[model samples]
Target: MSTGRDITALVRPPRSYFVNAPMGNNFGAAGDVATQSRILRAVLALAVEARDPGLILDDVLQWPAPFAFNPAPATPEAIAKQLRK
Candidate 1:
């Protein structure tokens, strides 16, 4: 499965599943079992049925919740504090 289409395309695997999700949350959102299951099943089914060598399947799924970037802490100590929590 790939979250970065550019990188995946360069590597060129036999068959790949591409998800338009965050780098880490590639299978859907956190705690969303239904979406995760669907993505897994689709990939597995494609693996079995795909005939082409450089086939790339784009997932129609989107993140359940809107995404926003959180501002980073100004200081290293503040970043460490958040991580230690």
Candidate 2:
């Protein structure tokens, strides 16, 4: 399963699953077992049932909230500022 649909399309694996979640939380939220299990089962089923090559089955599950990622410190000055945070 993957969260990067563009990357997955470029890679073009024989069988893959796409989950609409944050990068780190591909299966589901950190502690939501039910959602994770459902996504896992769907991925597994896609692996078994997908017949065409480069087929990507999209997950129906949705992330509950907006995901915001902090920008990485790219420069020395930025790094120093981030350290202060």
Candidate 3:
């Protein structure tokens, strides 16, 4: 689960963001990709719903993974830089 601070930041941010963590013990397990994809799709749907409802003031972020065994570190600034490419 994402920390309260992280979720707060997501909700406070002006732009949309997608946060991907790691699956639990099921990491690398069979059908993990399908499961993760489904999770992402659900999040996307929620984001769409929020937008349709004009709830842009709320958080439109996705936390696809509940656990991260060896996660990479990337700050929001770094991600923004990448998006400029």
Clash number for every model?
Answer: 0, 0, 0
10-57: candidate 1 lDDT, tens digit per residue: 999999999988778889888999999999999999999999998889
Comparison by lDDT, 1 against 3, better one: 1
Ranking by TM-score: 2, 1, 3
User: C-alpha displacement of 58 in model 2, angstroms?
Assistant: 0.6
Q: After superposing candidate 2, which stretches have Cα over 4 Å from the reference? A: 68-71, 74-85
RMSD of each: 5.1, 5.5, 9.0
**Residue lDDT tens for model 3, 1-85:** 2223355455654333233433342123346686556545655665565543222332233445465456579989999999999
* TM-score of each prediction: 0.73, 0.77, 0.30
Range of the 10 consecutive residues with the lowest summed lDDT in candidate 2: 64-73
**TM-score of candidate 3 against the unseen true structure:** 0.30
Clashing pairs in 2: none
Q: lDDT of candidate 3 vs native?
A: 0.46
Report the error of model 3 at residue 40, Å.
1.7
Clashing residue pairs, backbone N/CA/C < 3 A, model 3: none
Error of 2 at 20 (Å): 0.9
